[model samples]
Target: MSVVAVLRLPLAVDLSGFVKLLQRMQVPHRVSEEAGEQVLWVPDEISEDVRSLYARFPAGDPDQQLELPASGRTSTRPGFVQQLKASPITALVLLSSLIVAAVTLLGENLETLRWLTFLEFRVVGDYIQFTPLGDSLAAGQWWRLVTPMLVHFGFLHIAMNGMWYWELGRRIEARQGGINLLGLTLLFSLVSNFAQYVFSGATLFGGLSGVLYGLLGHCWIYQLLAPNPAYHLPRGVLVMMLVWLLLCLSGLVSLIGFGEIANAAHVGGLLVGCFTGLLGGLFARRKMAL
Candidate 1:
């Protein structure tokens, strides 16, 4: 799309203004000189900002700035998610869950999958969540910590989380494995949720947010450690994450966006995710002797 800059007078500020704006926006724009027209393709976004800057011009041609992306072909989401969906991680998770469901349905005892477990609350001074039951060495009451990451809030929440999990989880799970993925999820959740309880002190926390932010953090830091802009990870996942963080932190989205966000959980998850990714990268580098 065309980014308009007010030239203040008899205007024609060549193409350099476009570059400055893109630098300001912190996104790269594709610039090309085609025919007689100078074209700049900013992401499908920042087109408005570019336009807003254009609108400031007076009634005359000033001259009219063109936003090529808005007028040209629209950009679409990266193909990475589609590629990832076809990967083994997605298939394995789906098949495993289905198999468990089928076995639960067909077993002699005939226990349903839903009966396996759910969050149970014990209201003492405040809220309490039942954690996953791991061996004593891992987490004594840890069962109380891990369950939230596995449990979804509702159908939409579950669906969205599942979509991201399947899409993102596959690449990361492939990189880290079931054990590491579970470990990150658990570690981030325990730290973030526990911190949330400490600060918010609301009690009875439940959700995948800690783990979600953990994944986001891992993706963010991973990109920096090994810039494989071409690999399985979408190049813009981290950028989109920053946008989400800005929206959440700004509270500009609270009215229309996801109503309830445990900010503490987000902060805690992000910190842990970045830390894990850094450690993971360091360990890998040492092993490879890089």
Candidate 2:
């Protein structure tokens, strides 16, 4: 747990490129002002690696000395498109949400919504009536369980959710790997959708808000427990989300014409995400200790 100083330089020098390199390499580090100089601190064990890296491409003059591989060519960091290609799970989740939103806008609206939402069953007189999604599920369409997470009610809803998904999902994919992000997304979707169904009882509801809340909770708790810079979120962002959640649950959103928020799904997703994050953080700590 001890941090060792890896490099020190003038406070005026720009260290963005070098910092980005460290981030891309997944080397945990921190920068701080120390006695009129900027100090780079890293875990004690990685000091040698950091020093070796700096020796080859000194952070003191990052622009002039480019770090070349064995081929003597500068290594290019992946761009956004390249990142999307590398993180298939993050790409798939984002694409799925976008596709659903596009289809709902272009296709038959009611039909598309019905097809993607979570199903409910009701006893109507002497027979059991199933919702569109429920009927599809009964006929072996298994995707109904998770597709609800992609369904969006309006333009604003889809846009807001899409932005959050891109931001949070990519971070998880980058830091934890694509499979971990995919697993958490699926788990959050199922839990939140089921909770919403139970709370509302046969009502139609759909959006990525639940999953966003889940991602928020995951990152929030993971940062708290593990102290990783990658999972760090601003205090203001956390406070805003919590305030919005409280407002939704307090019925203020509906009263203010924002429509009914999926309060149950939000709460459900957050609780499950926090639990998952706690377990994941503990597992990571144990692994690091070993």
Task: State which candidate has the highest TM-score.
Answer: 2
The numbered model that scores best in lDDT is: 2
- CA shift at 183, candidate 2, in angstroms? 0.6
Each candidate: what lDDT?
Answer: 0.54, 0.78
Instruction: Give the per-residue Cα lDDT of candidate 2 at 115.
Output: 66
Angstrom error of the Cα, residue 121, model 1: value is 3.6
Q: How many angstroms is residue 100 displaced in model 2 relative to the true structure, after the best TM-score fit?
A: 1.2
Q: List ranges where model 1 is wrong by over 4 Å.
A: 1-141, 227-232
lDDT of 2 by residue, 1-290 (tens): 89878778898887777787776566799999989999889996566456656665555443544333434456787688877776788779878878988888722376566667677445578664666655677799787788889888777888888888888888787677788998999999999988998898777678888898999999888767666656778899899999999999999899999887899999999999998889887865554443
Tens-digit lDDT track of model 1 for 122-237: 33554444433333216344455554454443456555656666666666765555666666666887887766766665344445666678877886676566433322366587
Count steric clashes of candidate 1: 13
